[model samples]
Target chain A: MIAALRARNPIKPGKLRLGIGDDCAILRPNAGDELAITTDFSLENVHFRRDWHSPEAIGHRCLARGLSDLAAVGAKPMAAFLSLALPKELTARHRGKPAWVERFFDGLLALAAKMNVPLAGGDTAESPAHKGKAGLVAADIVLVGGVKRGRALLRSGAKPGDLLYVTGPGLGGAGAELLALERNPSRFTALKVAAPGHPHLYPEPRIAAGLRLRKRGLATAAIDLSDGLSTDLHHLCGESGLAAEIDATVVPIHPMAQLAEAAGWARSALQLALHGGEDYELLFTARPQTKIPRELDGVAIHAIGRMSKMRNGKPAVTLLEEGKAVSELRARGWEHFRGSSSD
Target chain B: MIAALRARNPIKPGKLRLGIGDDCAILRPNAGDELAITTDFSLENVHFRRDWHSPEAIGHRCLARGLSDLAAVGAKPMAAFLSLALPKELTARHRGKPAWVERFFDGLLALAAKMNVPLAGGDTAESPAHKGKAGLVAADIVLVGGVKRGRALLRSGAKPGDLLYVTGPGLGGAGAELLALERNPSRFTALKVAAPGHPHLYPEPRIAAGLRLRKRGLATAAIDLSDGLSTDLHHLCGESGLAAEIDATVVPIHPMAQLAEAAGWARSALQLALHGGEDYELLFTARPQTKIPRELDGVAIHAIGRMSKMRNGKPAVTLLEEGKAVSELRARGWEHFRGSSSD
Candidate 1:
C-alpha cells in the first residue's frame, strides 16, 4: 500500500526536500522564521459519515477543518500531513466510488492549489474490526503556515470595554441549515429574514477579514464564530476577563428564519444568530468607536454587543424580547450550537 | 463544544497575533527559515488496547506519536494540535484520568519544553458509542517543527549502488513486547532488550538521530522502520524507482530474540527483523562506502542491502544461502504487514 501510494504521487516541489512516503516530510521555511503548525482530526460519524458524506466531502471537509485553524491564527498554509483509517465497508465503497476518495482529494487539492499548500507525509490503517459498528475511520490534517516575524494573533488581546463585532452577517447560517433540512421550505431561502446565502454547506472562513482587521489596527481581540452568538460572545468575554451586554433584538437574522417560525418551527432569527455553530464567520473585539468600514471585501460588519465589565458578578448573556430583557434565547438547536459542554 | 474549548484555551498567545480563535494559527516564523509539520494517529486496539490504554495514555500516546513523526522527519518540534474522540467509558479510573491525561500532557510537554514544542490548539468530542465495547477512543496529533530546508532527507534519493542501512537495533522492540505481556517475564526484564524498555508501552521515535543526520548531512534517503524492514525497504526502493538486495546474515538480531530462540521458540530473529512493525528505527540509504557507521548514539547501523537495477529483468531480493545467491524476497509481505491487503 505504501509503495503503491509512493508510485502514485511523488512530491515535486523544489522547496520540499522530502514529502510523502517517509515517516515525516522535510522542508525549509523562509531564511529566518518560526513555522506555524497545527493538527486536527475528522472522525467518521463525528466529523463525517460514510453512509451520508461522500469521500469527496469527507476529504474536503477534513482538509478545510484543519486549514481553517491555521486561518484562524492568520497563517498562510504551507504543508499538510494526513492520517486516514479505513473500515471494511469502505473498501468496497471506496473501490466502487474510486472518485469518492479521489473527488475528496480533488476538493482538497483545489483548495491546496489555491492556497499553495503541499501534501507532506501521512499514514493510513484499517480498522481492527471488520464491522463498521466497532471502528472509526479517522484523519489528522496538519498544517504549516507562515506569519510575518513579530505578528501572530492570539486569544488574550481583548481588554475591558472593547467593542464586540462580527465581520459578516450572523444568524443566517443556522437558519440556512434548517432550510436545507426542511421537509418544506420556500420563502426562507431568498427572503430578507433568512438570506440563506452562505450558510448551509460552506460558510466562508474570514481569512481576509482577520487580515484586514489586523491591518487596520482595529481588532483588540478576535475569534471565529464557529459557535453561535450567545456562546461565542461568552468566549470572547471570558477570554478578555470581562462580561458583555448584547441587544438580542438587533441581531442579523437569516431570511428563512422568519418563515420557519411561521411553520411552528421554534426558531428565532435572533437565536440562530446567537448560537449556531460552523458559521465560520469572524467575531472580533475592537476599540470602541474605531473608524470602521461598512465592509471588508464586501462583507458587512454587524455590532450586536459591546464587551463590558464583570460588575454583575456573573458571566451572563441577556436577550431583549418585546423590548424586555430576558436572560436567554433558546432558538438554536442543541446540535447547531457550539460550546465546550459536550465536546 | 467549540465555545467551551475556546473558553478553555482562549487563543491567547502573548507573542502570537492570530491565536486560538482564528481559522488558522498565524505566527511569525522565528529567526529560522524552515518549518516541518507532521501528523499521526493513536487508534484503539491498533496503537492501544481499550482495556489497557487509560485516557492519559490515550492522550500521551497521541502527542508522542505525532512528535515522533516530527523526529523522524528531522524537524525541531514546535507546536501541536490534538483532536480527541472520548469514548463514554469515562472512568473514575482517576476521574476520567484527568491527572493522567494531564500527565500525558506533561509527558509531551516535558519533552516539548525540552524540545521547545508547545501544546497549541485542539478539539475534543465524545465518541459515538456510550460504552467501552461500544467504541474506541482515537486521537490525532499534529506536530510542527523546523528544518534547514533543502537539507531534509528523502526516500527517493538513493541511487543505484547505494548502500542500505538501518539505525538502532530492530525486532527487540517486538521481543520486548512479548516479555512485557508475559506473566512470568521478570527474568526477561533484566535483559538489555527488555529492561528499561517497554517497546509496546512506549515506542521511541529517534528524534536525536534524525536531527543529527540532517545537521551532519549523512543520509541520502530515509524512512522509519514502521512496518518492519521488509515492507519499509520496499517503500524506500519503490520511491527511488529501484530494487534492493540484502544479506540475511548481516541483519542485527535483538538479544531477547536470541533468548526466545534459545527457549525453543520457532520464530526466527530474521522473521521478526523483517516483518515486525513499530521498530521506529531509521531505515536510511547512503552511497556505498560512505562510512556506514557501526553505531549511531550506541545503536548499530547494520548494512543490510544495496540498491540495483533489475538483474535478469526481475525485481527480486536475493539472500546469500550456502554462499549462493538465492532469490528469497519478493514484495510478499508489505501489504499483509499493514493489513492493506485483503486476506
Candidate 2:
C-alpha cells in the first residue's frame, strides 16, 4: 500500500532529500525561513458521512483542513503528511483494485499537486473494530509550511481599532450545501469534479490571499474560518485581548446560503453566514489607515467589521443589526462537544 | 482543554516560537540544519488494549513510536503535534476530573520533557461511535526533528560487507513482555513508573545512540527496530539492494525473553528475538573498519550480522543457526492486515 501511494505521487527531488519508504521524510527548508506546523483530524461521521460524501470529498477536506491552518499563519505549504486508519473492507481489492482507497488518494493528491505540496511521508494501519461492530475511518493530516523569519501572522496581533476583512465572495455555502446533502444524500453522489458550487465537499484553502497579506504587510491578525465566523472572531478577539463589532448589514452572504433561506432550509442567511463552519476562508484584521485591496488574486475581499476595546459587563462580540438594533453575537458554532450530529 | 494542555506542558521557548492556541505553531530550526518528519498511529485494540495498557503507557507508546522514527534518521527532537480522537466516555469528567485524558497527557508530557521535545500544537475531537457501539480512542503523533544538513542516516546507505549493529542490551524484551501481558494483564496494572524492565509499556527511544553514531560518522545505514529484527533487517537490505547473514548464537536475547521462555510464555528466546516487533531500538550498519564503541551512552551495542551482495534467486536474509545451519529468514513481524489479534 505504501509503495502504491509512493508510486502514484512521485515527489521531485529538491526540498525533500528523502521521501516515503524511510522511517522519516527529510525536508530542507529555504534559508532564513521559519516553519509552520499544524495537524487536523477528519473522522468518520463527525467530519463526514460515508453515505453523504464521496471518497474524494473526504480526502480533499482532510488535506484542506491542514492547508487552511497554514494559510491562517500566512505560510507557503512545503509538505503534507497523512496518517490514515481504515477498516478491513476498505482495503480489500475488488476487480484487482482498491477502488475506495485509490479514489480517496485521487482527491487528496489532486489538491496536493494543485497547491504544489508533496505527499512526503506518513503511516497507515488497519482501523480496529470491537466485537461485531464496524470500524470507522480516521485520517490525520500534518502540514509543514514556511514563511520569512518573524513575518508569520498570528491571532493575537490585532489592535482595538483594526478593520476586519474576510476572503471569498461570501460565507456559509458549506453549511447550506450540507443542509442540502442531509435532505438528499443522492443529490451529490454523481458530483465527481471539484467546482465552486460544492463548497461543502471541496472548500478551497486561501493560500494565495494569506501569502499576499503577509508579504505586503496588509494584515495585523489572521485566522482560518474553520469553526463559524462568530466563534473564530471570538477566538481572535480573546487572543488579542480586544472586542469586535460586526455590521450585520454589510456581512457578505453566499448565494447558496440565500437560496437555502428561500427554500426554508435555514432560518436566515445572515445566521448561517455567522455560525456556519468549514468555509476554509481567511478572516483577518488590518490597521484602519491601510489601503487594502478589494480583491486578492481573483478572490473577493470584504470589509464587514472592526475590532474594539473590551468593556466591563459587555459581550466580546456585538452585532450591529440592520435597523440599528444591537445584540450579543454568541458563538453558536459547530463545537464537537456540543452535540454528535454533523454541522 | 487546549489551555489545560498548554499550562501542563509549558515549552521553554527556543526552537518553538509559538505553542498551542494558534492555527499553527512556528518553529525556528538551527542554521545549517534540515528537518526530519514522521507520524505514527496508536489505535485502540490494534495497538493497545484498554484492559491491558494504562492510559499513560498508551500515550508513552504513541509518542515513543514517532520519536523512534526520528532516532532512526539521527535527528534531534524538536516538537511533537498530536491529533487525538477520543470516545465520549473517555472525555467525560470522572469525580470532577478528566482523569483518563489527564493521565494520558501526564504520560506523554513526562516523556516529551525528558526527551527535550515540546508539545507544540495539535487537534482534538470526539471519536465517533456507530449505532450503539462504543467509540475507540485513536491518536496520531507527528514529530519534527532537526539534523545537520546532508548527514542524516538512511536505510539505503548500507554497502556490501557493512557490519550490522543494534542498540540496547538485547532484543525481544517488548515482545516477551507482551506475551506476559496477554497471559496475565492484572499483574502489571500497578506498574506505573517508567523503568528499564518494562520494555513494552515504556520502551525508550535510542535518540542519544543515533545522535552519537551520526556525530561520530560511524554508521553507514540505519533504521529503528520497530518491526522486529528479521522484518526491519529485510527493509534495510531491500533498500540498500544487498543481502545479509546473521549469526544466531551471537544474537542478544533480553533477560525478559529468557524468563518468558522459562515460564513457557514463548517457544524460544531466539524465536522471540528474531520475529517479535516493537523494540524501538536502533538497527544500524557501520563500515567494517570503523571503530564502533561497545556502548553508546548507557545503551549497549552488539554486532551480530554483516551485509552481503545479493545472489540471484537467493534469500534476502539468511540465519546461521547454532550449529552453522543456514536458512532463509522470512519477515514474520506484526502486520496490521494479517489478523485482528495483538502481537
Candidate 3:
C-alpha cells in the first residue's frame, strides 16, 4: 500500500530532496520564510462511518480538514505527511481485493494535485480491533506550509472596530451531513438538488484568498470556519480578548439549506448558518478603514459582523437582530472527546 | 490536558513565531537549510500492550521512534506535532480521574524537554472502541528537523568499502520484552540488572552523534536500528544495491542479554543481536579512512560489518561466525499488520 501511494503521487521537482523511500522526507522551505505546521485526525465513527461515507469522501475530508487549518494561518501548503491506521477488514487479502483503500488514496491525491501539494511521507499501521468488532480507520495528516517570516496571520489580532468576513458558501457540510443521517449515501451521488453538491464532497480550502489577505495586509485576524460560525467566532474573540456582534440577516445560507430544513434535519437556514460545522471557509477580520472587495476569485465575501469590546466577560459572541442584541450565540461546535453530536 | 502539556514544555525563543495556542505552530528554519520530516504510529496491542506497558513508557517509546528517524538523517530536532486517539475509557471524566492520560503526556513531554524539541500543534480524538473491547490508544507523531542543505544522509550512498557501525547497547528492547512477558512489571524498575536497564525504558536517539558524523563528513549512509540488525541491514543493502557480511562474534551484546536467554525468550546473544527490534540506535556506514571514534558520549560504537558486492543477486545479509558464513539472516522483524507476534 505504501508503494502504491508513492507510485500514485510522485514528488515534484526542486521542492523535495528526498521523497517516500527514505527515513525522512527532505524538504527545503523557501529561504528566510516560516513553515506553518498543522496536524488533524479523522477518526472512524467519530468523523465518518465507512459504510455510509465512500472511501473518496473520507480521503477528501481528511485532507480538507488539515488544509483548512493551514488556510486559517494564511500559509501556502508545500507538502503533507499522512499516518493512516487501517482496519482489519481492509487487510483481509483472502476475502477479496481491497479496492476501497486505493479509491481512498485516489480521492486524497486528486485533491492534493488540485491544490499543488505533494503527499511526501507517512506511516501505515493496523488498528487494534478484535474479530466481530468494527475498527476505526483514522488518518492523521501533518501539512507543512510556507509563509513570509513574521507575516503569518494570527487569531489574536482583531481590534474592536474590525469588520468580519467569511469566504465561500455556508452550511454545505451540514446539508450533506443531514442527507448522510438519512442513511442513503447513494442519494449524494445520484441526486443533485435533493442532496448536497460538490461543495460538501470536495470543499476547497480558501488558500488563495487567505494569502491575498495576508500579503495585502488586509486581515487583522483570521480563522477557519471549521467549528461552525458561533463557536469559531467565539474562538477568535476569545483569543483577541474582544467580542463580536454579527448581523443575523446578513449571513449567507447554503443553497441546499432549504432541502436540509425540509428534511427536518435543520430548524432554519439561519440556525444552520450559525452552527453548522465543516464549512471550510475563512472567517477573518479586517480594519474598518481597509477598502475590502466584495469577492475574490469569483467567490462572494459577506460582511457579517464587527469586533467589539468584551460583553460582561461572558461568552464572546453576540447575535444582533437589526440593531439590538437578540441573543448570545452560546452554542458549541465539534468536540472530539464528546463526539460531534451537534454537527 | 493540552494546556498542561503546553505549560510543561514552552517553545524556545527565535525558532518559533507562534506555538500551541493557534491554528498552526509557526516555525522558521534557518536560511539555506532543509527540513527533514518523519512520522510514526504507536498503536495499542501492535506497538505495546497496555497491561504490559505503563503510560510513561508508551509515550517515551513513540517519540523515540520518530526521533530515531530524524537521527538517521542527521537532522537537528525543531518541533513535533502529535495526533492522539484516546479510548472512551480514558476520556470518561467520571471514571475516577484519567491519571493514565496525564501520565502519558508527562512521559512524552519529559522526552521532548530532554531532547529540546517543542511539542507544537496536534489533534486529539476519541477512539472507536466500544465497551468490553480493548480500546486502542494510538499516537501518530510527526517530527520536523533541520539539516544543512543537500547534506542529509541517504541509505543508498553506501559503497563497497564503507564500514558499518551501530550506537548504544544491543538487544535492549528485546531484553525488555523478555522481562515484560514474564509479567513482573516492577522488576524492570527495581532489579535493573535482572531486566533491561535505562537503555530499554528510555532509548535515546544518537542525534548529536549523527550531527557530528554529518559535520565531519564521515558517514556515507545511515539508517536507524528500529527493525533489528538483520532486517535494517537488508533495507540499507537493498537501497544501496549491495550486500553485507556481519561478524556475529563482534556484535556488542547487552549485559541483560543473559536474563533474556535465561527466561527462555532468546536462544543466544547472537540471535537477539541479529533480530532484536526497538534499539533506536544509529546504524551507519563510513569511509574506511574516516578515523571514526570508538565511543561518543559514553556509548560504544561497534563495527560489526562492512558493505559488500551483491551475493548471487539474493541473500542480502550473510551472518558469519569466526570468519566463515554460517547462515543467511532471513528472519523477519515486526509487522504492524501481522500484530508483531514474533516480537
lDDT of 1 by residue, B6-73 (tens): 45444345334344443445544445446666666666666665445343434544665666656655
Show the colliding residue pairs in model 3.
none
The lDDT values for all models are: 0.60, 0.88, 0.78
> Per-residue lDDT tens digits of candidate 2, residues B1-343?
7888888878685999998988999999998899999999899888888899888898899899999999999999999999988887886678786577877887888888899999998888888767778788999999999999999999999999999999997998999999989889999877665666788999999999999999999999999988889999999998999999889989999999999999988889998898888999999999999988999999999998899999998899999876474899998875422343111
For model 3, how does the per-residue alpha-carbon lDDT over A170-240 read when each residue is reduced to its tens digit?
A: 65455445455545766554221112255556677888888888888889999988778888888788889
Best by TM-score: 2
Ordered list by DockQ, greatest first:
2, 3, 1
User: Which 10-residue window in model 2 chain A sums to the lowest lDDT?
Assistant: A334-343
Query: What are the runs in model 2 whose C-alpha is more than 4 Å off?
Result: A96-98, A322-325, A335-343, B96-98, B322-325, B335-343
The CA lDDT at B268 in model 3 is 71
DockQ of 3: 0.56
Best by lDDT: 2
Error of 3 at A69 (Å): 0.9
- RMSD to true structure for each model, in Å: 5.4, 2.1, 3.3
TM-score of each candidate structure, all chains considered together: 0.83, 0.97, 0.93
Candidate structures ordered by lDDT, highest first: 2, 3, 1
**What tier of docking accuracy does candidate 1 attain?**
acceptable
Relative to the real complex, the DockQ score for model 1 comes to 0.43
